[model samples]
Target: MSCGMFDESRDVIEYHPIPLWITPFFFAGSYMKKRIGKTSIAEHKKTLLPSDEVPNYFSQNNLFARLTYLVFWYLYVMLETPRIILYSLKKKPDLFYGYEVYGARVASIAGRILRKPVVTRFQGTPLKINEQRNWNTLYPHGVLGLKSKADAVIMANDGTHGDAILERLGAPKEKIFFWHNGIDINFVINTQHGEELEKRYDLNKKTVLLSVSKLVLWKRVDRAVWALSALKTDYGVNNAFLFVVGDGTERAYIESLAVKYDVSDSIHFAGAVPHEKLWTYFTLADIFVILQDVGNLSNQVFEALSFGLPIVSLDDGSTTGILKNQYNALLIKKQNIETDVPRALAMLIKNKKMREGLASRAKETFASSVCTWEERMEREQKLLNTLINNEHKTSY
Candidate 1:
């Protein structure tokens, strides 16, 4: 069946336009349910299946609790797989389009049983598949084996992820296709929250450095704070202020880092702004900084480019195609991030001409290549249509 495991309503936003019979498995909270209800998917599509609810005891913070949670979750998956297989047999779908890992696993198994093609899309770096290691203990060989069985594997971003799939997971190279993430360019450009955001943060005369992402270790938000501190001490850039937008587990640790660096006053933690309001922060920023070491591309990078903000990022695999050194963005050498990041930030902060040059090129690059959601949707549709048509042909 054409199925997906819904992590959030945002997942629907990407795949919504595809003209296919879709049944989403909602594993989100009540707020996400409300969000999904507002979408056209809720009205047009078949009823969404609710994921098996686990007990509150699973929430306990201990090894036993964690293992118990995994055990229960695996049991739920095992129980659900039969239902999915039965549904697939009844529907005889052209192909299965799996969104997340769990969905992909279910679809892979179902596809194998029914002798149907499975197209799985990896939105982010697949769990435990990165430069650091070839294998993830959490994912295990069985999960990877199931993933490798897919007829086609579509990655949301290019670069390192494709390599990870082929080299690490032993997936066939021909099955891999890279579709760079896109954003609503006009929406970001026309969005007008600059004045209000500036006033809210008292960013009247200060040069604002914006980082919009989840507060996580992989994101290296602490490094961003350290860069800000260096921008002051090393480069003598005191007027520069950082506005961190988004919240996660590392928020407290990041806050402590800011305080430790004595740049707490300069760093404004505008925790978890609404997605719609993100454009304002993007528009108001003097420079966009992403210290993410993992994942090839981010929606924030595209959004920042769309908003015409100059970017300074580490020259890691994630920024491979999207960021060009001294072109669209200033990519610092990852080896010397502690020194190079501050240098890049200082260079952009001090030189308006350079910033404008990079910003102009960045916008031009985005406009020509990854501009809007429509363009991305069209590409995805083409890929999906090809897969479905091929499946039909093979069946006939």
Candidate 2:
């Protein structure tokens, strides 16, 4: 059975194509419904998007920038969504799950009005968002309104995000299920043998330090560059080099910082590589660094773990819960760079055995403890099924 927005040719659900959002949950929902022999529904907003999602216009003088989404995207969704929904309703799907952050509210409303069970996954706290003008209008009160109406809300990570939804948004804590944002362990551990990956990246005799998130200020890609600069200047680490994968609005700014720090020649910007090819980069790296000030359990960190590489990240967001200091990962305190990051990096670089030991533990953890794509789908399914099976037992 196909559910959500399944693209049959890709054999997967089309989630977020652009980086404005993360769509793993959408894929998770589709995979579950497909396995269960049920179909899921993908519903778009009934009205035009609030200015929050797309605050800027094509051109400062363009008249269309001031026009309502109703005149543009809304009309398109209005024309397409109903036909899709009606066709599925006529066939009577076993379950209807709405996925994604912005569109989940509309899906929940449709499910309620249609007398069908609905489940929505909440991945991050309102605090974790970029807080730019466009995002403010797009997700105003977070997804609290829709979550209140939803039968179940699945949280991708744990702690503060769930606390905000329950205490601030009034969502019942019991109705929210926390699923660790996971990676494909097998994909990482069993990637194309190490030698071929090294040759492809030309990583001969170079100690590769990799950062794999979108180049954004909050992510602090500059911090990695600063650390690399310190490595060269303070420790004479001539063999160390850094590879930054993924692109975003901050690309130019990051490049500028690298040049300013005089480490431009030591860094590589490999933009927006597809998922399949990511493992090759992972295999080439000796260490992975994630310096994002917010959010926990980044996808890049997990992919690094699959390759048995030691990970270094700030103990903020979900990072604290997902990783332990000096265990599977090396944890640095937030904003304690003067005291911790340099010390940690220096320690890891100086002690090859310790770094490799952490890598082995990380691999073992990914294989034995971390959830895979299939496990994540089942966990999401259980939450949705529980919501559907006992809809009236709890108040919204």
Candidate 3:
């Protein structure tokens, strides 16, 4: 939305998700059989969005939950697809841009029904999205069908990441675009929250280990908590403190793991930190950790890079070619993650010199390699404008 290339109210009709029901126990995603319609501008932008506030009530990896989710989603798409077609007919917008799996499917169906062009973006690695548990929105064959229908498909990568999934999906080579996710580098470099975080957490005296991600199985935040336990038990690193910086359906499971591992006292759940103030935790940490299962080099990883914290992550398919081990990050193999993650954390905790060295390398690498949000905005504007202006353009 910061890309403000087009006025949202007139030119675009994007999805703006909001809670259908909110309480201490049941959240928006948990309110099944609830879908409301609203149009409003996000606080940061003046763009009007067609809010399809739907219930995403299930986030569990179980046979019953999956079946229930399918039922709810089918009901939602069946009801919502007509409204989208009606809106498209009334507005007659030039393009239909659908985000992620479900949105893309809905848009593709509606676009086909109306004989309109559609553009869809793959938010994560599309092939094995099924393994993400409740985070999975579509099956491989379902996405394969969506890819074939879309006029253009956007993948969030700098072209260094492989395109085997696209090849497997049979997405048109000519219609593919590579636009990696970028960050506000200057904001992170310039912002400082001072000593309050340090004083509150006593970070100066502790080996502060930070993991910033939604508490999801795909994100593998539970691995970080287990590593914290291993540090104290196996390595005698009792002063280590782990700060987990996001919450989700997997939060209770992770909390249970912390208790099971006996690291609850040393673990601090910061929940969801506001974007503007998130720098405080970033700046107050000694080492950063994330074990993204599908090798998604996401925003939190970029934020960790900007903070110049030594990172501990997996050297997987996506990150292998991008993040070099030791020079920029300390990467471990996935086969032995339970053992390797904890051992890697222990190594970082014991060696302060190594931590400082890796931190310096990370900052230097980020300065040269990463693109800022402004640059991303420019690229997106150019591509989208071309897509809109030319009705006969072949490939970009």
The candidate scoring highest on TM-score is 1
> For candidate 1, which ten residues in a row score worst on lDDT?
49-58
Which lDDT tens digits does candidate 2 get at residues 158-246?
Answer: 33355444444566776666667766755543265446646655678777888898875555676787788777777777677788998
> Which pairs clash (backbone N, Cα, C closer than 3 Å) in model 3?
29-56, 29-57, 30-57
Q: After superposition, how far is residue 310 of candidate 3 from its true place, in Å?
A: 1.2
Best-to-worst lDDT order:
1, 3, 2
2 or 3, greater by TM-score: 3
Error of 3 at 331 (Å): 0.7
Two-way TM-score contest, 1 vs 2, winner: 1
| Candidate 1 per-residue lDDT over residues 1-42, each given as its tens digit | 124422121223112221222222223322343443222322
Model 1 scores what on Cα lDDT?
Answer: 0.65
> How much is the lDDT of residue 9 in candidate 3?
38
lDDT (Cα atoms) of all candidates against the true structure: 0.65, 0.60, 0.64
**Compared with the true structure, what per-residue lDDT tens digits does model 3 show for residues 70-184?**
5545555566567767766776666666666556666667666766566776654534432334233434323433453566777777322424556545666777776668787
TM-scores, all models, native as reference: 0.77, 0.71, 0.74
Q: Please list the residue runs of candidate 2 whose C-alpha ends up more than 4 Å from where it truly belongs after superposition.
A: 1-89, 126-148, 158-163, 186-204, 387-395
